[model samples]
Target: MLYEKLLAPLLFRLDAETAHNGALGLLRRANSRPWLQALLAGRDRAPEPRLEQTLCGMRFRNPIGLAAGFDKNGIAAPALAALGFGFITVGSVTPRDGQPGNPRPRLFRDVPNRALWNRLGFNNRGADTLAGVLERQPGLPVPLGISLGKALQTPIDDAFGDYAYSLEKLHPYADFFEICISSPNTLNLRELQEGSRLDNLLTGLVKKADDLARSAGMARRKPLWPKFAPDMPPILRDIALTKCRELLDPAIDAVVMGNTTIDPAFNPDPAKGGYSGPPLFPKARDQVRGAAARLEGRLPLVGNGGIFDGGDAYTMMKESGCPLVQLHSALPYRGPMIARRMVEELLQAMDRNGVRHVSEITISQPSRSSK
Candidate 1:
């Protein structure tokens, strides 16, 4: 209440990116100091055993995760984990280091809609630096998922090499690998999401992951999930799913339902960036449910976009058949405590329905005859 009524107003006064960086800086400092982190960690960091979920062959303390864009460089991940997210996904880390990304003012705050428009273009310190950062932590409090993307200048033909290189360097450090082919900011990035191109990309990636896993002596291969864009046409989405089932290796795990959307409807302004937060929830839910129906329980889905509160999260899981859901934009509006609030709300919903595990909330899959 204090943050919404007072501190948020002060923070909102700064440019979107400035405020974000400032908050991140504070979080980084707090995280660096064990005493400060513990002082701030309080109840938001507590665990609800009932909300624990097993997905992609790993146990998530809870289903709410900090989405990829939130920590593009893997900086402050330990701090974010201390804030109570069940897991933390860091980096859309590219093959090379120190990519400047899109020009500044790349992030905008849509106050009325409780949303954000970002054209960050996978900006980060790159995979090698990220590996070093992760190495420093050595033991993260939560399961860590790494999101991989090609450099903006990397041509579509050479994209496989970019992705493969990053995966090879970082595979030993991640619990799962998310191939990001969405993000409307990069030039022709969405083109990689096309059926044939995506298949080629994943085929190469899966093989690379297998090689890395063997050399690393890892017991099992890390889960590989492709991050998708929510705005894909129905036909394309179905085709994409078919390609997923056909091309993805059996060792590949689940699919992340989406990244930010480029739909103009969500951003009434003329800005050319992806829209996230509340405006994205409806379309994202529809896509999640659609994917669930098509997948028919064969694969688990991670629901994302516009998840602000527990009801929103619960509804997303129920209607979309997602066992786990993620939030990015919500954190800015609702504050760092958002994850704990969401978990509490989701647990309440679970209690109302007499369910224990998160997976019990299911949506019926459309039958083949109906389709």
Candidate 2:
């Protein structure tokens, strides 16, 4: 209530990126205090048994995860984790240091539509810096995944090498790695999602990640899920999924079916960046539905994009037959209590549908077959 009535409006008055930095800075201070996390979480709530799921060896208290860009360099992940998120994915970090992203005013908001537009091209403190943060920070309660991307200046041909550097550096910290080849903000990064290029990238990274985990004598190889763009053409989406399926062994464990969408159709402003929030819900859900059909239950797909509530969460999982879902753009609008609200409403949604466990969820609506 305080957030919606006051803090949000106050923050919205500032520049989008500035508001984000101020909010994150507050969470960073909260990270050191247990009570602060509890208060920010809205309550000392217990995990609802109905929402818990174990995917890729990680136990998720709920299907709602904070998407990658929100906690880019891992600044406030621990505090965010305490806010009832099932998981927290940090980074989209590049291998090289000081990759100053695109110029200012990179993040924009559309309050009336409940959406955001951004071209903040993989901006971060780099993999090494994130590695230090993870090493020094306390471990989170929920599963933590690191999103890996190529340095903006790196040649697309050597993309895997860039991802490999981050993989090796952050391997010990991440329970999973999200290969982000789909962010529209990065130059030519999405090309890595094309046929043979995707195949080589996943295959090579899979082998490299395994080698790292083995050398370090870790309990097991970390899971890797490619974060894709929501606007990928159906043909390219299928090709990417096929390559992922082929490399399932000691490779691609799950898939984050999308990042933000760059489709002009969703953005009324004709902005030169991806669009996220409610407007993207339908397209992103359909994308996962298609991917789910193509994979034929062989691999798990993490349904992501435009999820602002438990109804959307339920819809994402049920309509797409995906076990999990993630959200980012909803945060500013929904406030810090977003995850908790989503969880409670998700339970309400589950009760209404007579559904018990989230894993037992399946596609409920007639879906278009992948083209």
Candidate 3:
């Protein structure tokens, strides 16, 4: 209530990117003080044990996670985790150093829709700088995920090298890695999602991660997940699923559904930046349902896009069969407490539905002919 009634109005008045950076800066500073961290942590109680989940061999306190793009440079990760996300995804970091992103005015807000349109182009200080920061930061409250992406200057054919370099550099710090092949803002980046290209990329990166794990004396390869685009055609989504099921066991660990969309209908701009917010729920939900039905629980699905409240998260779990859900745009509009509120709502919905465990939530698959 405080955020929506007071903080949001004040924050919204600033230019979009400026507001975003300002909030992150405050958070980063706050996290440096013990009392501030304790105060923030005290606001939300722990989730009930029934919400506990183990996926890709890691135990998550709950299924709610902050999606990848929110903390793209690894700044303020522990502070973000203190907000109560079960896991925090930091970085869509590239191998190159200091990549300047798209021009200013790249971020626009659709106030009534509670949506964000952006073409920031994966701007970050690069993998080496992020690795240095991670080495010095305090232990996180939850699992930490690193999202690896191809460098903007890299050729389409040489994209794998960029991903491999970022992975190797950040491997020691990350609990898991999300191979980001789906962001719409990067040029020809989505082409990496093509069948053979995706396969080869995942296959090679998995090999690199395993080799690193062995040299570091770990038990198994670190978890590798792929983020997909919400705007994919049904056929492409199907192909992506088939490839994921065939690949998850050996080359991948889980799948995050999906990145922001490029649907032109959202605005009048010819640029059609990646769209994320309330309007994306329907499309994201359908993709989750379809992907879940296709995978048939073979690999876990982490649903992203358009989740503003606990009810939205519950629907994603029950109707779309996502075991875990992630939030991005909602954090800005609804505030940091969104994750705790979501878990609380999820538990209430579970009681109403007479379901006891997270695994018990599943929706019937629509007939194959519907595809």
Candidate 4:
């Protein structure tokens, strides 16, 4: 209440990217204070009866997570985990060690619609630096998912190698891995989501993950999920699912039901970058449900995009058959308190639905038959 009513308004006055950096910087510094960490820890609500979930062979203290792009470089994983997210996903980290990304003014806020648009272009300190940060930070209270992307100038043919390089360096630190092939800012990146290209990419990635697991003497391979675009048509969706099934080994754990949307209907402002928030709700849900139906419950789905509150999150779970969901834009609109509120609301929904455990509700619906 205080942050939205007072602090956010002040922050809103500055450019969106500047405000983002400033806020992260503050959190990073404050996180150094034991008293601040204690305060944040106390603010976290006690776990609800059925909200604990174990997915991809790992346990999540709760279902709510901070999505990728929030911590583009893994700088604040410890702070975010302390604030009570079931998981903190860092990066969309690229393989290259060069340029940080587009100049300022790359991120914008469409305040009236509670949406955000960005062409930040996978800005990060590169994979090696991110690996070092992960090693230095205290281990998270919950799981950590790392999102990987191809380098800015890497050609499509060589993207697989770039992604594999990042995976090799960061795998030891991540609980799960997310392949980001859907961000619209990158040139021809969407092609990677197509059948043929995706097959090659996953083939290489799965092999690499397997080798890493064996060498580390781990019993199970890490979960590797592909982040998808919300705008894919049914035919394209089928191609995506088929490709994933054929190419992505069962060792590949889950699919996050989207990155963001490039659809103009969702973004009325004619913004250049992908748009995320409430407007993306319906499409994101449909895509998740569609993918679940086609995959026939074989894949674990992490639904994201347009989750503003618990009702919205519940809708995504029920309608899309997603077992887990993540939030990004909502934090800025509702503040960090949003996580606590969402946990409360999710517990209420589970109670009303008579679901004993959250994972039991995941992918409960079978795909609808085509007419």
Candidate 5:
């Protein structure tokens, strides 16, 4: 109530990137003050078993995750986690040497339609610095997913070493890894999502992970999930899924069905960046639906893009078959209390839909589906 009525308006008055940095600074402050975080969270952070879900053998307290690119350097996870998210993904972080990313005025608000245009690219402090940051981060009640992207200077052919370097350095901090090859801002970045390239990247990553696990004497390596684009045409979508089917188990743990959409309808100047918000919901859902139908429940799916409320989350679960979903632009429209509200509303939605829990809404999953 207070956020929308008071704080959000003030934040909106700033430029998008400035507001974002200001928000992270606040979260960093909260991270230094546990009591303050709790006060802000109120009764919102408490767990609801009805929303509990299992991915692989791991349990998530809820389905709502703060999407990657929000906290690009793993700087605010502890405090963001305190805000009642099931998980927080830090970074679509690049390699050892970080890149400056795109120029100023890269992030814009499509406030009228409740959307954001971000061409910030993958700016970060590099994985080396992030590893140190995560080392000091206190453990949170929820899972933590880290996104890996190729270094800006790395050529397309050498992209493997760049991503592998990040994975190896940050492996210990991540509960699951999100290979981010779908961002529209990076030049030729989406090229990695193609069939042969996708196969090699995932295969090499799983192999590297296996070696790392063996060296540590751990039972299993961290889960690796590749993030895809929402606006992919049928043929391209199939190619990506085919690569996924080939790798599913020890190679790929799950799949993130989308990044943002570059559709001109969603943004005034599509080249500046893609859009994330309400208009992206149907596009993201439709893509997830098609992928689910094709994968036939072989691999679990994470849905990201324009998820604004509990109804959006519920529909993603029921119609699109996504058990896990991430929110980005909603924070602007709905305020910081969004997660708690979404959790409560999703529970109510489950009851109205006649399901006892989120996992029970398995209409899209096939007989083989478990996660």
Candidate 6:
């Protein structure tokens, strides 16, 4: 309540990126203290067993997760987990040897729409640093998904090597992996979503994942989920689905339906990057629904985008047929308590809809498909 009414407003007055860093810094500090953790935990609502879900071979205490791009370096994973998220996906970490990102003023707020636009360009401490962080941190209370991407200057042809390199470094640390082929800020990155390109990339990545798992003595690879864009054309989306079916190994677990939106309707500013928040909800739901239909339960989908409340979360679950859902923009607007609230709402929605399990609600309803 304090965050929504006061702290967030004051934070909003600052530059978006600056405020983001400040908030994260505070969370990191709070993470070091037992009392603060207890205090925050005390404020949270008791966990609801009905909200728990098992997806992609991992058990999520709740369906709600933190989307990628918030903790781009994996520095705050333990703290974010302590905040009551079922899971936390940190990083769109690049395989680059060094840290590189966009210039300042890369993030902007659309307050009325409760959205944000950013062209941060996969800024992080690089894959090696992220690996080290993961090694040093205490194991989280919930599952963790790591998002992978190519470096800014890496050519599209070389992007596969980049993604694979990051995977090699971070796979041991991730319960699931997200191949980010959809962020609009990277040059030609969206090409990975195209038919031939997507097929080639997944084929190579899947092979590498298998080799890594075998070498590590694991029975199989971790979940490999591709995070897509909401604005992908129907033909491109179809291509992506076909490629996922044909090229992805059985070890590949799910698809995260959406990274952010490149749609002009969401960002009228021609120069702005991908937009996210409430304005993105309807389109995101449509994409998830389409992917769910196309995949036909072959792969689980992680629904994300414009989820602001429990009703919004439930709508995404029912409409898209996604077993797991994630949140990002809402945290800033509603604070950590929002996670607890969302869980409550999701359970209530489940009861009202007569769905016995959260996974059952995903893609359960037939609607106008996007592709």
Residue clash pairs of candidate 5: none
Query: What is the per-residue lDDT of model 1 for residues 1-371, given as tens digits with 9 covering 90 to 100?
Result: 65578778999999999999988887888766766665554454446788776666677888888899788888788888888888888889898684889999899999989988888888899999998888887467788999998898889889999888889888778888888898888889888889679889978887788788888897667788898889888888878877776655433377788778877765565364888889888889888888877766656678888888988888988887777888999888987667777888988988887888776784322222312
Model 2 ranges with Cα > 4 A deviation: 250-252, 362-371
- For model 1, what is the C-alpha lDDT against the true structure? 0.81
lDDT of each: 0.81, 0.85, 0.82, 0.81, 0.83, 0.80
lDDT of each residue in 1-371, candidate 2, tens digit only: 88889889999999999999998998898888888877776775865887776667778788888999888899888899888888999998998573878998899998988999898988899999999899999988899999998888889998888999999989889989999999988889999989788988998988897799899997667888988888998888988887877776422288789788878777665464888899998899889989988877777788998888999999888887888889999999878899989988988999999998786795222222331
**Candidate 3 lDDT, tens digit per residue, 1-371?**
77788899999999989999998887787667756755544475755799887677777888889999788888899888877888999989998584877888888888889988889999899999999999999888688999998777889889889999999999889998998999988899999888889889988987898899999999898989899988888899889888877666622388888778887754335374888888888888988888887777677788988888888888988986777888899888987667777788888988888999887884222222212
The residue-by-residue lDDT of candidate 6 on 154-259, one tens digit each, is 8898888898999999878999888998888888898888867888888888889999999999988877888888888777787788677665543346778887
In candidate 5, what are the lDDT values of residues 1-371, reduced to their tens digit? 88878888898999989998998888888987978786666655556888887775467899998988989998889888888898888898998858888999899998888888889889999999999999998887788999999876788888889889998999888888899999998888899999778888989998998888888898988888889998788789877887887776722388888788897765567966988899888888888889878777777788888799998998887886677889888987786677888898898898887889777874323333332
Itemize residue pairs with steric clashes in candidate 1: 277-306
Score candidate 1 by TM-score against the native. 0.94
Task: Report backbone clashes per prediction.
Answer: 1, 0, 0, 0, 0, 2
Lowest lDDT 10-mer window, candidate 2?
A: 362-371
TM-score of each: 0.94, 0.95, 0.94, 0.94, 0.95, 0.93
- The Cα error of candidate 1 at residue 106, in Å, is 0.8
- Score residue 212 of candidate 3 by CA lDDT: 96
- Which one wins by TM-score: 2 or 6? 2
Model 4 lDDT tens row, 1-371: 77789888999999899889987876676555656755534465566657776667778888788999998888877777777788889889987462477776789998988899888888889998889888988887799999999877899989998889999999889999999999988889989988779888988888899999999999868889888888878789778887776655443377787767888877675455889899888888888788878777766678888898888888888776677899899888886567777877887887788877776767632232321
Q: Candidate 4 — which pairs collide?
A: none
Off by over 4 Å in 1: 38-41, 44-46, 249-252, 362-371
